[model samples]
Target: MTSAKSSENKQAFINGWKQSKLVRVFLYFILMLVFFLSSYQHLIVSDKNMGENTSEKEINQETPIYSEYSINSLDFLEHIFDKLEQINLDATFTYEEKTEIYKLYFLEEYNKFVEDNIKTMQQSEDSLDAAFIQEIENQLIDQQYDFPVEAFFKLPRLSQAEIIKMSAVAESIVKNLMKEQIKEADIMRGKVAEMVNASNLSDDDSRVLVTEIARFSIFPNYFYDAAATKEALSSTKTTETNYLQVVGLILLVILFVVFLYMYIKQSNLQIRNNNVQLLMLVFIFIINMMGMKIVALGHSLDYPYLGFLAPVALGSMLIAILLDYKLAFISSILFSIFASIIFNFENQMFLFDYRYGIVASVICFTSIFAVHKASQRSSILKAGILITIAACTSITAIFLITNENVISNYIFSLTFALMNGLLTAVFVIGILPFFEAAFGILSPVKLVELSNPNHPLLRKLLTETPGTYHHSVMVANLSEAAAESIGANGLLCRVGSFYHDVGKTKRPNYFIENQVNSENPHDTIDPDLSKSIIISHARDGVEMLKEYKMPKAICDIAEQHHGTTLLKYFYFKAKKQQELTGELEEEVKESDFRYPGPKAQFKEAAIVGLCDCVEAAVRSLSNPKMDQINTMVDKIIKDRLEDQQLNECDLTLKEIDTIAKSLKETLLGIFHSRIEYPELPSRDKKGVTKDEATVSI
Candidate 1:
């Protein structure tokens, strides 16, 4: 039996996929591809700088590059040669110049030795000029230059013969210093001190000559060759993909999809059945992933934690408003995982950044819970402020835990978190109307707007059918109280009640509630004709609501409020007349006298319908006492339950009893003052209260 059941369910799933959801599943597949490609950079497992010269096995863009003197020393020599030639420099004039010239010409060792033995890469001209000037002043052992002697002859521009001698001495000192593999900038003067002490010249001449060489000679060069590394990095391509990570990503995505499917199946089956709502969820999810990916790309810039500005809570907030918050919670967890992967670069393999993920999750949590049932635009802003507090709190906690204690970094992260919160709320508020219009779903804000007394439909109902309008208002009061007592949507019930009898506007006198005079439209009509007119109101109200572009929930309540129950007033009147004409009960089919209906499909509809009957029944009394109102409320609820009108809805028998009690209490309050009026002794006539629930019909 279990096997058969499983097979049946599997087949049902296959049939469903082939019937309607194939396109949606295909779109999710495409989304998976987008996610994989957008996150490709971090998914790569292989080393980016896979060369022997790279000092670190794993290299990101932030790692500084170095060029060793041996591998690129010849290129450095040629670079200096080109730079000096551009300035029309004489190669034999300066120490750096003579060193190159002696290696190229005198020693005939240009091919054997590194060019000028230059130790550093060429920076921009401005940078090199600044470095040269700064080094000349700071590199010497003696702080003082001979300013008085420079009055006769400046230190750098000596006579030609003195220039020749000093150039030769400086060149020899540089060659000896290069042979010692001078690598530290801070100790260049100390090394020069050793070279000067060992010099064959007088101490003053050697000291003066070493100063010139030290300025140009001190730089770390015998290091990881940057030019070779650049060449390798540019040439390197990750041809071998990380199939493990790819498989894991695919599995994770499929798992998320399954989790979402199961969650919705159990908790929000309405979203599963509604194609537009399902499409809305997909749109929000894809937009969130793309938004996070785009924001994470900003982390490559100068900002240390740019991804904190991503509106990571956007999807959950939108879903919470437009759909159920329970669904929003599921979406939030999946969004956080994607955020963790997309914003991560601090870990090896750039796998995850728990800081960003935790902060984003916090904001998502706060936003969904805060604004799930919000009824005003300003409420979204309030939720945003709450999200900001939560996001900043998460950031501070994460930073403290990670020991990233820099105050400025903390300030920047907090600033971006604030923006993230604001943007999340603003985006949700801005796009909400468009989603409601496009998806045909009603949010709390839209519901409140529709509930306004001055709305066009409500005004029309008041002007054209004032009696029915007042009747609807009474029903709304009862419905809201009853709905809240049963943990149903009270606002939806109230709003639905306001428009439930709007069809009376089309033929105002046809309904008793709208007839102010003694004229009766039903009196002239036959019982069958009266039944048709009475049943037409539910369908007509639905049409009017549709014409006004009212939300489906309100339209549905108008349509299903009568549920297929018997129009007993007309049916019984026809039965009585038929029996006088010698017809049997079976000859007058009961089904022919019923309202065409799909029944109440949810608790709100059932509550509204129940309260509609109870209110009309109680109002039928000329002077209903509290005890009479209580009996009327309980009898109507009992009648609906016995007729199986509430079977399709999720309301329990216990909740029905609760709704009956609430309706009785609300009716008591509304009619309590009426008890003080003079009682009509004829108010409790036998036939008058027999079928009071059928007063509207």
Candidate 2:
């Protein structure tokens, strides 16, 4: 007994938790927190460069020193030799004169180099030894006349052996000069310093000359400082300071809260009232965040815009189709913001990437508009194509405006943008069913699918109770028209009308519509028994719909179409029979003949109920004229209003009037009068009535 009580208590607790709105709200809050944490992980933590860490591998493996020196040295040598060649071949001066002029020019350049280096070194904070400076000054003086001017001047007129010997001597003089300068000026550091000090460069004057030339090249001063480089690399690893990260996180939380508050305000609690919508919104948001994470993983790739291909429109399309345009629009904006953050992982300076954000937002916004009214699967593909064009166009325009990359890079970005659209379509198609089933959302596409005549319940209704099927078709027309007139869910009303009378197939002959051949099953049965059969159809339809796993709204329409209204025909028959039997002592109760109903709880269900009565009453007329149709529609609406059938729904009086007018117009169009034809000759060669004659004109 104790185990049984405990089991019962556990079941009760589970039921209570399931129905608790506070628990659901808390669950949504937890989901939002998960999204926040995931976003932070992908955008900041995963980048491996957004936090402080002193220990790091040095980035001086390819420190650009050798390449910088080699290129500059080659350029300097080429410039000096070209000048010398120009002076040597001059016809206006002798060898001695050219030699003197070249020496003067070389001395002038040397003086300028000394002056520049002295000034730069004095201004810089690098600790220079006073002895080194004095040595540098002494070397500059010694190297002023160190060049072998006479040998170099005679090089054009000397023999090959003499020229080679003279070249060697000149090279020795330049090498001594360069080595003196390099040693005094601290030109090499780190590994280069050790290598130069230990190496025997007596025969390799070329290396010394290049190093000296590179020292005087017009490149920015760079020195190898192992400690400083390590520090800079460690700093680079952190994108933002701890204070800034905390501030950004707070701002993100505030922005998300504001967006949710605005969403609730704009929707007027519709989302909060419907747990399914709230859950779906959270589901789409999480999916979008996951897409962002997937895209952020491609940051290591060369293309910076690769994150733009995250299929931002996937969530927007699902929201627009499964929810409504308003929520989809808001969701697109939020998704674009998240896209910007995800794309900004590499660029640590900016918190958001407006370029990718604007493009993504535009594509998502355009896609929502493109698929807002999508009722078929093909429309989803068409929306994808349209959004692809929009995305490509937007990307091209941004690239053209920014001129940030070459044409090929722009082309690559455009290709990614196009792929974004195609991926969105694929994902929407694949995941839409899961969302619809999980949330129990009867999307327009699903409604259109359910409205197909080949559906099992619809087919059975057509085969067994053809009259009810025809009546349902007429009622669907009326409901669709009325729903459109009031700006309600016309497709939902139409689809619900088709399945409303599905239970009539079980006992077709008992209903008046399927009782063909002028037979009435109610005539042979007691009025109480007939009323039971009549009211049982509504409950039976609800049960059958539940078995088929139809949407709750459709099931509600089937159950509440009669809406607890008294079955007056059966009730009046019961009273008349009771009077004939003279059993006046027994009281007649209206509740006994009424349907078991919770009343229509939404606009679509209420409109379907109104249209159902209007269609049946209009069909019963011998010939429904314009006046009769209008009168019948108004009467049925008035009776429903008086019976308080529409009290539970959100329909206003003006909308109700609009529904009546629309139904009357639709019925008039369906039952319009035919034009009269003149008399025609029959096959018997005798004058026959126009109705009976079959003329082959």
Candidate 3:
């Protein structure tokens, strides 16, 4: 007795904590954190991929740092550029001497460069920027500063007007090309080539300008950096992979997951109250995300677009099976978005990026729609086949967007898409049992199997307490009908009804349903003793179901179906006997005769509890008319409502009315012939009465 009270108190505490607002808030925060962490890896990975753009030789090369001593010291050359116009071409200097004199001006600028670099090198070979600055200084000291004599000889041949015109154009071109930054050789080569091609000058004149600009005239400011050039070009294309965009995308996904949390709370109350099941949902999301990441390894393989082989629909299919389909529907959107990020062509992380998002969404929705109501494991394979068709259409649609219009080119991608569906089916079939068993979930298929009469518990109930078993079957029929009418799980209701009375088998003769032709056990015992026997059945049934490792939902229905209603039969009998024995009516405490209940916490349990009461009540009537059936059903439901038995469940009053009406319809059909003809007629020629003839062998 002490252990039972302790266990009951522990259970009460757990139930109270589960319903606390703090637990709900913490769970929502966990869901958001899980989703955010799933996206956080993309940031690390994308940054890691940044270094992959350049090879070891390029990455290891010293970076440019000219600020140490100003080796990029072209500032001193601004005034020196005027030295070209100082020559006297007509008399004091002959054409050859004039050419040599102008060449001396360039040589002066060149020599000044070599000497300045040598001075800069003396200041710091020891600074942090020493290595790269020394490399630049050494290059300046080593290169020859001689004039391009052969090309510049053509320059002196021209008159002063021609000399100034060519030199100014050459100087302007060099300065314009050298401004800001020039990463590689091709940009400089292309600009020079374009100028040469477009110039109307004589070939000799243009050749003179090219040599002057390339060798003698321009300062030593030209620099080339391979890493910078690659980064600059990549930045133009992959700006979406930048830090800000990725952070924005992660925040958006977090918002969507919050919506998913809200939807689960509103649509599936049972799942919301159980934190283990909620944690299981988080695990499912993680598993599918990991699957997507693993499949993405094929993205780099030689096979064309092998990312199409990712099982995009697997998450939705598993969710549809283990939890609510409405959650699967919402989670499908999130799953597809995550898959798109994994299989993305350009590493784009936008929430609705179309490259892979469209294909993934189609596969996810197809799998969910096809497998949500599935009653057998094989239905997953069927959903896979349907997903394959969707993949083909979606892949083809993607092809049209990419302008890969040749029908033959789609064969490889389409084949992989076909493989995607098969992969989804394989993964779902493989891990589904693990989830169902680990979480103790009652799926439709499991419910169907449990409803079989050959199960050990059901068979025991049938053989040991046949009357109670018959009553249970009647309740199953009525409850399943009522549940279906209210958009509930009819299969779960039927299976729960089968085992709800299994505890009566423990004391078969004590309960009236199983008394058969024997004397009433209650006649020989105190009313309190009979009441304890009656109340213990509901409790014993829960323990029995748990011993068998039944689903938690089935066990809950067994425990809560009776709620805390008064056992008026024994309560009033005790009170009447007390009055006759000269005792006060107050001697019998009403609470002692009531069932210990936590009330119905979910719709299916509430529905089963109502049907269990109504079925037993209607069965007591010798001939229950349709009006009589409706009246009894309404009264039972009304009593439960007034007693606050249905307060915990989400069922509304309108659904209750519909359920009451459905129960009446089912009971009337069950007892239709029994009501129409109460008595058996004479035996037929075959020696069987009318009722005996209708009974199955």
Q: Which candidate is the best by lDDT?
A: 3
Ranking by lDDT: 3, 1, 2
RMSD of each: 15.0, 13.5, 15.5
lDDT by residue for model 3 over 359-446, one digit each (tens)? 8888989998998778887888999999999999988888877764333347878998888889899998898878878877777767
Model 3: per-residue Cα lDDT at residue 130: 41
1 or 2, which is superior by TM-score? Answer: 2
Candidate 1 stretches with Cα past 4 Å from truth are 1-40, 47-241, 251-279, 299-303, 346-350, 385-415, 484-487, 516-521, 575-592, 622-634, 641-644, 647-658, 661-697
What does the lDDT read for residue 535 in candidate 1? 88
Q: Which is the leading candidate under TM-score?
A: 2
Q: 11, model 3: CA deviation in Å? A: 5.1
TM-score of 2: 0.67
In angstroms, give how far residue 76 of model 2 lies from its true place: 11
How big is the positional error of residue 547 in model 2, measured in Å on the Cα after superposition?
Answer: 3.2
- Give a tens-digit lDDT track for model 2, residues 62-179: 3311100111223334455555556656678776776677657665766665676656545646544344344444554543334445444543343334323333433333333233
- Number of clashes recorded per candidate: 3, 0, 0
TM-scores for the candidates: 0.64, 0.67, 0.63
Candidate 1 versus the native: TM-score?
0.64
